[model samples]
Every structure is written in structure tokens, then in C-alpha cells.
Target: MAPAQSGAVLGLSLSLLLGACRIQAVKLSSDNLTPTVMEFQSVELSCIIKSTKTPNPRIEWKKIRNDETTYVYFDDEVTGAFENRADLLNRASLMIKNATRTDTATYRCEVVAKSDEKTIDEIKIVLTVQVKPVVPRCIVPKSVPVGSAAALYCDEKEGFPNPTYRWYWNSEPLPEESKSHPKYVNSSFKVDPKSGTLTFTSVVKADTGVYYCIATNQAGSAKCEGHSMEVYDLNIAAIVGGVIVVVLILALIIMGLCFAYRKGYFANSKPSTSYKTPAKPDCVNYLRTEDEGDFRHKSSFVI
Candidate 1:
């Protein structure tokens, strides 16, 4: 009985060890990685080796970002498109030099040891790259008179790959027509992808609505809403505004008068509590003829 029990316990212990070996040592720092495109940018991917043992024999890095094809694997020492751009930073980390928008994808690390033959340990990491772009918003005088031109200035901030610019009037896109106006750049609207600045010339009343500044590059596209504009027609607007004010004032006065009359007559009046003496029935017949004549006269007065 003792020997049989010992064999069963040994079998159970081996099963548990096998389970541990099946588990991989590599673990990535994050799962969802997003990055933008640009030049001279560096992105780092990190992983942790779960095993206590050092001098990890075979550490491998691979790019598995695309759906169709798998990229470089460190074990093969063969870099596909990544080539020299991919580097294994020790056994626990990988770095991509000069990361561009195209280099963004899912990465994986695999660690293989001699202790467990034909058994492999592995993990996955994700890399994100972000390329900023030039965006513009309009800024100008607070108010403009009707039929007079308004000046609109646009300025762009930090962006990657030096985003290109496009101007929009309302939601409708604007064509690249070169015309001369007086605002910023010449009428054609100057755009410097490097500086990310867009300037508008003399803006007309037709341009007095919402404007959109669109920025795009190989990394991605982004847009921002510009300042709203309203070209005022002083004459017609002033007349309409005055009429609205007068109507509101008159309506308030009429409502106030009706409310005061109702409060005085209906709410403030008190009901009579004293009783009156009953009329004598003996006078009923005598007063009948008199009452009929009085009623006829009252009807004539009402008519």
C-alpha cells in the first residue's frame, strides 16, 4: 500500500511541473499600443522574463503587426523590412530605432531554454507611434460691418511629419484657387507644411460662418473648428432688434394689468356670513303685476 501511494503522489507532482513549463516567461508591459508617424523618433517595447534563472539562452523578438505577413524574428537574425532598425536591448527589452508610422505594430518575445526540450516560452508586446500635424484656427476682429471684408489669421502648432494644410468654408471644402486678398498670405492661402501655418486674405460675408482647418500626413489626419464669424448688417439688424424689445415690453404690461384686476376682485373679496329675513308671502299676488311691468322696462334698458 505504501509503494502504491508513493507512485500516485509522484505522478501528481510531475503533472504540476509540466503545467509550469507550459506557461511562458515573457509578458509585455501593455497591450494596446498606438503611435504616430514622423522622422527621428524612437519607440521602445518592454517585456518581463518570469523565470528566476539568468543567462536566458535563446531570446527572440518578432514583429507580428500586419494581418497578412509576419516581419522580423530576432532568433533568425534576419530583419525583414525592419532590418537594422530593430534591436534587442538585452534579453528583456526591444527597441526600434528611428520609428516611423509604418513601424507601428504588435511585437512578441520568445525565450527558449535547454531545461525543457521542445518546450517554448513566449509573450507579446504592442508599440504605438504618434505623428503630430499642423492645425489652424481663425482669429480676427470681434465684429465686422456688412459688405466689408474681415481678416482671418491661422496659426498651427506642433505636429509630426510636418502636416499639410487644407482650408474649408463651413463643411464644404475649399478649392486651391489663387486670388489676392488682404489678410495673411496672398489670396491663394499660404501653407507651409514645415511651419504648419495657414493665412486667409480678405474674408467676404459669404465666409461669415464656421470654418474648418484640415491637417493630414502619412501618420493620420486631424481637423479643428475655427472661430465663428458674423458680418453684421447694422441698419436692418438694429431695426429688428428694437422691434423685438418693444413687443416684449408691451406683452409684459398687458399681462400685469390682467393679473392685478383678478387679484383685487376675485381673491381679495370676502363672502357674506350674516343671514337675511325671509320675504312675506302675503305681498306675492299684489307685487306680481308690478314685478311684470318692472321686468319689461329692465329688458328695454338692457337692449
Candidate 2:
């Protein structure tokens, strides 16, 4: 080969090696593991790029939850959903303020180098947001007929680690089986601890009182409002008695009417309704009799 051609080939090889060395020189690394944080607090996740092939490596952050991986930071700005509470530092870490349970997810920090046409590095951080259970909402029957089914419902939606629920009767925790409460041997009911439901297959008269539901989690516990239940038995015998009394009153009225009708007690007392007298005039006028002819009566004295 010619000396000039050989020199050109060698220079090209050196340049390729130098470029490879520059890319290898970029040191991007971070060691962040699963971290737990309380609600309404600040947390920082690190993804340090010790060195980069390019002087200006762009930083990006994304969140992974369930089936979705969405951008948290892009183009040197936090996205609209997490704008106020999220911040980036030194192109390697993310700071979040007032974290909530909804913010609990896996965060990924990705660094990209435009000059090297490569992804510098990426690190994953798991974040868990611990939150206490909020007050539970409950519903129960105010009253139910005896021998009927009754159900009480309770739920606590605002909590982390999914709260476990329980039921209480008269301020005492009610068990699934009546045998747990020795004093209430006749009680027949079932309670689900997770769902906080109290159910009775056949409510009895004794099952009439206020009840409560409680929700608990790793952070704390909470309770729902009081719910009162009343079971009553229908008194058919009293209703029958009332019907009999009403029938007797109606029969007595009917008997009195029949007897009065048979005895002509409704007849009119007088027959003068069809016989009316003629009207008489207050003054009577009569013509002078002709027995005294030409009898004139006049005032004679002029004085």
C-alpha cells in the first residue's frame, strides 16, 4: 500500500477509537431503591450523571403505574399534571413536594446525549406513599320486619395499602359467629372484616340497636357514623281484634236503622204541608148603603 493511503487509514482508525473512548468516558449511574414516604411530605429521587459525552445532556422523568408509563418531566419542564410539586435538580434528581397516595409509583430518570446520539443512562426509583385511613361511609336499615333479611354496608376509599374494614355493635366489635359473643347466644348474624358488612339472614326483635363500622390500615384507623337498626314483629291478632270491633260498630248502626224503618219512625208529624190558607188584606173598604137617599155630609160652618 502507498504511505499516504496507509496514513489516512490509521488516522481514521484513531478517530474512531477516540470517539469510542469519549462515549465510554460518560459516567452515568445511580443506586436508588424502593423508598416509602408519608403523604403531604417531600421526597427526592437521584439519578446522577457523573460525566457525559456531551456537555449538555437533556434530562427526562417518567412515571410507571400499572399499565401506563407517562411523562412527568419533559423539555426541561414538569408536565401540567405535576407542575407545581415536581422539580429537577442537577439533571439527575427529582424533588416532589406534598406527595399524595395517587403519586405513589415508579419514577424513571433518563439522560440523553445529542452529540453522541445515545441514551446516556436511566435509573428507576420506586415510591410508596403512606396514608392513614379516612372516615368510612356506611348504610344500614333503620327498621326491618322480623324474619326478613338485613344488611349493613361500610366502605373507606381514601387510604393507602387498601384499608381493612370491621363492624361494631353497640361499641363492641361484632364477630361473624354468635358463639364469639356468649351473651348473645340467640343472635344470628355474619360480619365480613374486609368489607365491613353486617348481614342477618333473619332479623329478630332483639336485633334493635345502633351499630358502627371501622376501617384500619398500616398508617391509622378510622370509623364511620353510627347506624341504628330496628326489627319489629307484626301483631296480626291485634289487627284482627280491631277489625272485629269495627264490624260490631257497623252491625249495631245497621240494626238500629232497620228497627227504626220497620216502626215508621221516619213519618211526617202533620198533613198541613199540602193545605195552605189564603192571604188576608190589612184594610177593608165597603160602598155606602142606599137605605138613606141623598144624605150628604159636609163642613157647614165657615168660621
Candidate 3:
């Protein structure tokens, strides 16, 4: 090739390189896409601008939760609930202090570089703030009859990720299956950790003890106050005797009623034998006879 042609090719190549350098695209990324932190702790959401020509890019942060989006950082300032507790780190990443359960959501870092070929870029990071469980409410029966079924319950609503449950009897942790442990061999019970329910198929006197429950999560654990339960024996013989006595009394009353009916005690009385006189007739016939022509008359009453 001629020297002039080579110089022309070199100029074209330099121009193409300069154009490529001027049109650098804006790209966003993060070291950690998903971060988990405990409640009331500090967390850093790392957002990095990989490539951009614009020196002063407009940065904004948005939070999405339950299909609702809200601004966390806008107009170069933290807004809303994060006004005082959040700040921008390295002009791109987000720094949050005293993170709470409500802060657990998907956070987006958006950058707008008008001078770049790709004017916008965004990165989404999921933040999870785990909350510790609060004290659980426990229900234990104070007294249960032996050979009867009994149920105990424990529950709490404040924990994140839904805490699992553990039961204790007399300050000793109870196994998930009573039959699996030799200590609880005499007790026929089952425990449900997710639902916090302890059920006994047939309670015995050995099952009587103080019971408590603990709720645990990734963050921490909390327990409920202990409650006492007592299992007592049922008096089957006494119950049977009472039932028999009641039946005997009912039978005696029925027999007395039948005897009274047979002896005529409740029969209707006969009417008195006093006589009633017959009423007199309402009409009578009269007769009169003339004896002679001397004007003498005789009268007689017809019966």
C-alpha cells in the first residue's frame, strides 16, 4: 500500500476509536444482589457504576414491596421513612442504619447519564431484615383426667420467617416424638413445631408437669412463661355405684306407683245414694153436677 493510503486508514481507525470511547454505555452492578441483616442493625447495599461517560450521573433509589414502589432516595436526599436513617455511600451504594422488618424489600438503584450512549441503568437488590420472635402465649390445661386426651398450644405473631416452636416440660426440652425418647416412654404425645401444638393421646399421671414453649427464628428466640398441668385418676367405680343407686331409686318409685294403682288409692269415688223426689203435675181437671131443678150444684176435683 502507498504511504498516503496507509495514513488515511490510520486516521479512520483513530476516529472510530475516539467515537467508541465517547459513546461509552452506562452500566450498573452490585457486589451482592441479595443481603440479609438482622433487625435494628446496619446494612450496606452495594451499587456500582461499571461504565459511564457522564461524570455527574443522577442517582435515585426506590423500594418495592407487595407490588408497591416508593422512593427511598430522590433529589439527592433520603426521603420518607429513611430520611434520617439512610444515606448514600460512594455516591452510588445505599447505607441504612437501624434497619427494621419493614425495610425488608427489593431496592433498586437507578442512574441516569444523559451524556452516555445508554442513558439509564439500574440494579435491583433484595434486602431482608429478620425480626426476632416475641414472647409467645401458651395455653395449658390446669387439670386433665387420666386416660383422656389433652392439648397444649403456643403461638406468637411478631417473628419474621415464622418462628418454629419447642416445648419444655419441667424445664426439660421435650422431643418431637414422645416414643422416641426413653424419658417420655410412659407419655403418649406428639409435638408440632410449626403449629406449636402438643397433644397427648392418653394422659397419664406421669405426664403432669410444668410446661413452657419457645419460639425461635434466624434472628433470635423468645419463650413463654411456664404453666402447671396436673393429671388425675378418674373414679370409675364410684361413678358406676352412683349410676346403680340412681337406677334403683327410679325403680322403687315406679313400683310404688304400680302398687298404688292396684290397691285403688287413686281411683275415682262413688256418688252418694240420697233420693230426689218427683215433681207434681202442672194441670188438673174439674167436674160439676146439678142434683135437681131447685138450683143446687155439687163440685168434685178430678184426679
What TM-score would each prediction reach against the true structure?
0.38, 0.61, 0.74
In lDDT terms, how accurate is model 3? Answer: 0.93
lDDT of all predictions, in order shown? 0.59, 0.82, 0.93
lDDT of 3 at 198: 98
Writing each residue's lDDT as its tens digit, candidate 2 over 1-303 gives 999999999999999998787665455666566778889989887778876668777888999999699999999889966899988866768888999888899988888876664546777889999899899989989999999888899988888978888788888877777657886678788888777778888888888989988889887899888888988888899999999999999999999999998899976777556756875334433335679555333344233
Q: Where in model 3 is the C-alpha error above 4 Å?
A: 1-23, 245-303
Best-first order by lDDT: 3, 2, 1
- What is candidate 1's lDDT per residue for 136-208, written digit by digit as tens? 5545455666655444554555554456766666676555443434342333344444444444444445546
Residue 217, model 1: Cα distance from true site in angstroms: 11
Q: List RMSD in Å for every model shown.
A: 19.5, 10.6, 10.0
> Using lDDT as the measure, which candidate wins?
3
- Candidate 2 has a TM-score of 0.61
Worst 10-residue stretch by lDDT in candidate 1?
294-303
- 138-252 per-residue lDDT for model 3 (tens digits): 9999999999999999999999979999999999999999999998999999999999999999999999999999999999999999999999988999999999999999999
